[model samples]
Target: MNQHVIRPVRADEWEKVKELRLAALRDPAAPVAFLETEEAAVGRPDAFWQERTEGASHGRSARQFIAEAPDGTWNANVVVLVEEAGTVGIFDEAIDVDQGHLVGVFVRPEQRGSGLTEALFEAALEWSWSLEGPALDRVRLFVHEDNARAAAFYRRFGFEVSGLVVPMPTDPSAKELEYVFPRPAAN
Candidate 1:
């Protein structure tokens, strides 16, 4: 709830980006909230971070945003994966939906209940809706079915389950639920 600023990721801040990602992976909920483990993330070389940030930062459709505290640490982050029309894999790939896939959403525990999540969602979805040409029809995110707290939060934020379940890529036995928020008709 402090005066943290949310903005698109800067091209040169790959180091901070890497640091924040590692920090998120270390969070207690990382098992359910993130796909990559701390070991996997920390093992990546500097080159990976450089390319990752450059690609998303300069991309026409996808983008990453961070909430930075005044002391220069990132309090939270969100990445919007844009799925253009006629594209598959946007929402479960097999379904072929025109939408924006929201992923890699994380907020530090200290910042969890201070409206930061909602603000981050607002920024990510706003960016998704503002895409030109083929407008994104919906915005969606995947949440582990076992993560009840996350599910509750998503529901409060206006996302409803699409009833589409996908196995976790890392652990095929577990299923993750897909939640979606359709773009407002008048918007």
Candidate 2:
């Protein structure tokens, strides 16, 4: 079980965020699990990470959550981006509903099966469904078809295939399947 704290990344933690991301990019699953390459992430400037951290830390539309070990290491992380209905999606398509899109999911190899990823996701979903003004309609994630381990975990976590598929940005011949956790029915 994971006893570590799961919380949003702070504005000043860009270096730690970068470190965790780089480590994640080196994981064996990274090739199919992430859209960006380690080489690309390593080449980004400090300013890019700083700005990205700042935005995620304070922005209303996006947040990055981390599972921090007692020793202060970030063991896992997940980022959620709010897509407003009628807005352009990250893929440049139209977003038909207000929703949260999970991305940049990673868990350190040592933390695998230790419940850290679930803790990270609970924090993310709690944050997502709690957003006010105009509440989100659902939270969705895309998994590479080849990443069966990830997709199976997502199913166990309550996300269901949304019957939509899109070409992976890195390989047009490969596909990414959409899964969603719609806002829980009103209690």
Candidate 3:
């Protein structure tokens, strides 16, 4: 729904955060769209979810945004993690430039094809580019190569493949392709 509010997740909403994640992991496309399974997430201690929510809830290094229905339900979420130049990143690889990596992407099945994903990215990109003290160069995401639907959406959203391939952690034979939203030129 267009009325759905898009905003950053708050520190105190860990329970809601965990709830949405579990739902996301249970989606049929979850296997390719998410790294964690529902079973694994369900077994994690509450503290882990709390700490995770708290960390991303308030920080320049990471931010998680959600689309909340008017009824107070969180139907979708995405996290943008900052990767500073020359620092180690989530991929356990060296970072070449400052950037924002979008991860933990999820949209409720009922909410798909509603333009909600674009709204979420609009918020994320707005935040990413608005950061000061040496702004980031670009925003990027990795999509599983086998997930054709997602890859198509990313392309339609203006994210171009950067020619980088990441080996899947669970199945090295599979791969993830990097896509980036090019930085806007100075106005």
> Evaluated with lDDT, which candidate comes out highest?
2
Reference-based lDDT, each prediction: 0.86, 0.92, 0.90
lDDT of 2 by residue, 1-187 (tens): 5569999999999999999999999999998889899999999999999999998997678999999888898889999999999998655667999999999999988889999888889999999999987899999999999999999999999999998888888898998899999999887
Give the clashing residue pairs of candidate 1, or none.
Answer: 89-93
**What TM-score does each of the candidates earn?**
0.94, 0.97, 0.97
The best-first sequence of candidates by lDDT reads 2, 3, 1
- Candidate 2: where is the Cα deviation over 4 Å? none
* Cα-based RMSD of candidate 3: 1.0
Q: Regarding lDDT, does 2 or 3 come out ahead?
A: 2
Clashing pairs in 2: none
Candidate numbers sorted by TM-score from highest down: 2, 3, 1
For candidate 1, which ten residues in a row score worst on lDDT?
87-96
Model 3, position 34, has a per-residue lDDT of: 81
